[model samples]
Target chain A: MTKFTTRLPLIGIGVFAVLLLVVAPAVLSEHWISNLGKYCCLAIAAVGIGLAWGRGGMLVMGQGVFFGLGAYAMAMHLTLETAGPGALPGFMILYDPLAPLPAFWEPFRSEVFTLVAIVLLPVIVSAILGYALFKRRVKGAYFAILTQALAVALAVLISSTIRETGGDTGLSNFKYFFGYVLNDEANKLMVYLIAAALLVVCLLAVWQFNRSRFGELLVATRDAEERVRFLGYDPANIKLFAFVVAAVMASIGGAMFVPIVGIITPQEIGASASILMIAGVALGGRASLFGPALGAMAIGWGQSSLGSSWPEGWIYILGLIFIFVILFLPMGLSSLFDRAKGLIRRSSDEPGPATPELREVVK
Target chain B: MSVPDASLVVSDLHVQFGAFVAVHDVSFDAHPGEVRFLIGPNGAGKTTCIDAITGLSKGTGTARFGDKELLGSPAQKIVRLGVGRTFQTASVFAQLSVLQNLDIAAGLRRSPVSLLRARRGVDASVERALEETGLGTVRDLPAGMLSHGQKQWLEIGMLLVQDAKVLLLDEPVAGMSQDERTATGELLGRVAANRVVVVVEHDMDFMRSFATRVTVLHQGRVLSEGSVAEIQADPRVQEVYLGTAGALSGALAPGAEEVD
Candidate 1:
């Protein structure tokens, strides 16, 4: 069972890289490329979900808090970049013409600071949150609900702070990204490439983690936390690490979401959005390495295509699929492949009467 | 008696849940190189005693392993202090292979950075644990798929790989057949050669065969402490065992002198 996570799907990864880097760019128009970029960011976040929820048994329902942090961080810097040096953003000027730039927004003017904030912001917040939650051993549904509430709270806070954060309208209309013109087709592709490349990097990192000793410990902790404690490990620390990593990954996805989608709204990093991310992960086989990413991308594609045709009805479709997966294929759609293989290889999946451990005990 | 630095000395331990005291001033000492047994009828507080010693439950009084106090420290800290325990139901990592379970247990001294890389080859300690537990043939099989007795051995093997100086196993042979029970006894004999092996059990036959020393507990306090032969001959143990468990088959040792 664990062999799926341990074995690196080399051919699959190579094909994915080609499609993301080469084939898609050559064949598709810019509109679809931009859509794929959004999906890429979502997929990046899903990989982390797989690690946290799938492997570590942490149902991190408030991942959008971290996503919001990264997206807003990147958006603030870009908004400031569009405002020119020493000038307040246009929204602040519109809301209060004489108001000074918020102190928190001032530091984002520096490119280095913006870059650091993308990763560090989520790390610090998640470190605190994870330390508190995991130390108390808050788990399962309670942990999930607590995290989801945080995302809602953050969204509400952002919604109310119209001047400082642009509130519900969010931060957009970015003319430049790190001195590069966002309007340029080549620059747009470059941003897309960056997001795509980062998704690949995240997948590789998680792959390494899945096969590593930490991965085994994470699984052990998930399956039987007390057993892990008896094995001389502080389960809190193990859980904290996975949760923080997942948060950071979500943050990175949000940061990338800004440059790709050209917007960072509270709606994108709220409770509903966070649930959507989880929906994708659960749709994919959460336990497998590529499941969450593939699942998220599939969901993204569905939203763009089927959603365009029937916006209200698409949600029903998603709900039905979710219910079906949860009921029959709890492992997600990826397990469908396993099921097919099981039908072909009937008897191989189960240990037969020949296992020496069974034979010796029987004798 | 003076307790050695390597011994697990649990003295006057008191554990309470609300107003009811589960373990009321129970005391016993287990040393390396012997298999210690804690035997009692149902609700005897034997499980509570080990739970407190392993820091799974809060308790008063001193349960010491070397210089470190076991009662106040956390579960992982007690484990780090070289004490390991197993649950009554065999709490091995069900989804992981036996080898993976042992690998995770043997990683006490591993650095966080090194854990990021995949394991290249099995550690000598893990290999030794596989050999010791007799799970070598099924090392790659998931622990959940193992036979009931094998899961118990795997749990013990996990502790062995951690190099735990003291092992507290709760009902290690509770669900085993006669053949499996003898095999487990032999395994415990080999494991106790250079460590403190403390077992909380109810099977009188396995206890008589494997226990180097026995402590009987009734209702939360220690009733008797002595060698297996001495405990068997004690009239007090006879009254507790025969009085409460005479109707229950195999709760008393075979061919013991009946109260006459």
Candidate 2:
């Protein structure tokens, strides 16, 4: 098949995604719309996971670290915005009303700083970490373990600093987002729209990456890093680039998630949370263009419904789904789409009358 | 990109892995337009020497491509210096098509911004390489499905697409049918016509037919370096082949000869 024809499914997905995000909000109830917005945030993070884990073979189990970074950055700014310029945040008042506003939380008062920090913090951290890890050729399961450990460390650090980070209770109780009353239902819908739109943008960006030479090189490095090295390319740098991009994507997801979810906690940025993010990507199909995002949304939706209905049994059901997908559909749900397409094509292709040469060849 | 006539020159190269010394004081000069084959016994450290030159292994030596010092350079830098190599085992991107495998090697744009631009998927050089390596028929097929011989050719095609001046291959034709071997020998000859080709292989018939010069290595050192005919006639080369274990014994002499 030509490149254009091969891209038909991706284009179809892009259209479906646009319709779902732009049109569905009008028909769905306010609560379901917000739920979808939350799913969009998760989907954004899962897209990055798919790129790093599925395409680049870098199992980034610490995405929650970047997500948490963005989340807290935005949360701090929102908190500061709610309070007057010199006044302390409400959470700090609960811990120590006498103590002055922390020096570290001073810069987040500026809206631009928080926005920049949301993208820059993850980029800087992931760059340094990726450089060190890839330079030493730390990959496969070792890389995954290191990233998971980082998530655990971040969670522990956040949990220990009770007064500074709102302790285990986490950051919440936001009254405003960018000077607009978040309490207003219209403004809430606007936040959901922004998150949904950003998810689509992330999907487009990933689509570009999937078709680029860099994407091809990334996959090549994943498969046979030594061969890519022989091809006048540094496998480490290639992997590092993908890793950093994934981090930035995760950060953006986390930033948007804070507004939609109205909470940021150590529990959401721990090793288990990171594993949950990976589970969604793995269930969808890591290598497929649309699979990761769709899979993440599906999983997030399942959690919202299933966890609410059977909070005790939901984890078991998700585990079963993960096991089933892994055991039977190693390529994930996307492979089924491909198989179905192949079957249709086969059935549609009518056989011509058999020639003597063809008969002899078959014999 | 000076297009140095002497593309690769290794002198006093040594590779030691912990307590075990893999390669010791191995040296050679590779010139443009000549196919030099490094033939040796099973444990002769030929791969170590190649790895040392390509910067895959840490070694103490002066490996110069023109005026550029290559000993301490990274593998990517070494390639950018116009030296390309193929693994002992044919390693192609199994998930990608033959055409894509070549395009990725040909496209050489390694940068963060390069991720935004869509790859053309085929270039003139990629087309030429595909035609030259006889993989044109299977260009669209995934490389994983290719026969062993075809995969080897595809890898060579990958190197060609890189526009490499110095091509180092480890056992390019290790596993091939007689017909495939002959075809590969011809392909290597054509590839070496305009570039410096360094091959580490065990096929005596292939070396005798294809190599312009042969470097015999034994016990991590250079045993002999001369024309294929001269090396074949040397008694020391014969003794090493005959005396080494059964694995090395099977390497050169197709039928075993009495050692006495």
lDDT of each: 0.89, 0.85
Alpha carbon lDDT at B81, candidate 1 = 89
What lDDT, from 0 to 1, does candidate 1 have? Answer: 0.89
Q: Top DockQ: which candidate number?
A: 1
Measured with C-alpha atoms, the lDDT of residue A229 in candidate 2 is 88
lDDT of 2 at A284: 87
Q: Candidate 1's residue-wise lDDT over B89-118, tens digit each?
A: 888888888889899998988999998888
Runs off by more than 4 Å, candidate 1: A1-8, A347-363, B1-3, B244-249, B252-260
Docking model 2 quality class: medium
What are the DockQ scores of the candidates, in order? 0.59, 0.53
Q: In candidate 2, which residue ranges exceed 4 Å CA deviation?
A: A1-6, A350-363, B1-4, B109-112, B243-260
TM-score of each: 0.94, 0.93
Cα displacement (Å) at residue A153, model 2: 1.6
Q: Which ten residues in a row have the lowest lDDT in candidate 1 chain A?
A: A354-363
Q: For candidate 1, give the DockQ.
A: 0.59
List model 2 lDDT by residue over A1-105, tens digit each: 677885885786679676766677778888898898889898889999999999999999999999899999998988888887888998888878999877889
